[model samples]
Target: MRIAFPSTEKLGLDSPVYAHFGSAPYFVIVDADGGDVETVENKDLHHLHGNCQPLRALGGISVDAVVVGGIGRGALTKLNQEGIVAYRAVEGSVSENLALIKNDGLPRFNIDQTCQGHGRNGECIH
Candidate 1:
């Protein structure tokens, strides 16, 4: 199976997951058994929500699972509707996060929780 982890930098295993423009995509594709890794730039479709196309963008890839810091309910619903497992409360670099996910499995992301609307550091609240 192919696993995808969102990250900040392309190098390292724990680079942290942050959005560049409402689209914080730092996906790392890895083999389930050997852990072989390949990196892919996730399409930033946050700006193209005019017709709800982000889901299509994500679906373009062969990702089975996604690890992200935080996401809104709308996005979460879309992911779930598409049969993609969404992991929340995640933070770290692409490589390190992948290792953590590979070894620890999916962590509790608190999907029901909402942020109080903070700026910058709290921009991902939802």
Candidate 2:
């Protein structure tokens, strides 16, 4: 499976996962079965609206799924439409979160719960 995780850095799987998909400087693409990983910059994505563009950007990569800390309802819906399952991963570095997703497929992506308490921190809201 080709899994893409929004990240701030390109230092392998240990890169930090970004809170918002759009603002993520680059996306870390991992070929789970092949164990190959690479980073792709999001210059083509317009993330300010927090809408479907990031999902579209991901679609271009042919990613099978997206694992992230949180995503808005609109983005989530679009991702689902594109056949990409959304997994809610919270409070972990990039590698750890991706490993969790690989070990357990489609874990409960509770956007509401994981995105809570984050509003105060000025991060993206679900």
Candidate 3:
């Protein structure tokens, strides 16, 4: 499966996972079966409240799922509509989150569990 992780930097598998999906600077795409990895800049990183377009930010890169610390309800819904699943990520690097996924430790993201706001006040609900 092709998994995408919101990353703070382009450090490949060692990159720290960013807290907010919409504001993350980079996305680390990993091929689970092939062990291949690539980094892509979030083009639509900046946006007004309730206007996060994650798919556009992804630049059309095909991904089976996303592992993130937090995500907004709209973004989560959009991802679901597009057939991409989102999983709540643990507090760690991309590799650590991957381990959690392999162990079935991460929970599938739901609209009810999405972040309440844009995380501007440092209150991420995820």
The TM-score of candidate 1 is 0.67
Candidate 2: where are CA atoms >4 Å away?
A: 110-122
* lDDT tens per residue, model 2, 31-106: 8889889888876366455444755565478888778777666666677777887787666676788778778944
Give one digit per residue, the lDDT tens place, for model 3 in 5-78: 99879999999988788888899999988999999999888777578898998989999999999989988999
In model 2, the number of clashes is: 0
For all predicted structures, in order, the TM-scores are 0.67, 0.80, 0.93
Whole-model lDDT per candidate = 0.55, 0.71, 0.89
Task: List model 1 lDDT by residue over 56-121, tens digit each.
Answer: 544467666666666555556666676777665344466655656667755744448423233675
Flag regions of model 1 displaced more than 4 Å: 12-15, 19-22, 45-54, 108-111, 114-118
lDDT of 1 at 114: 27
TM-score of candidate 3 to 2 decimals: 0.93
> In model 3, what are the clashing residue pairs, if there are any?
none
Candidate 3 wrong stretches, greater than 4 Å? 119-126
TM-score: the better of candidates 2 and 3:
3
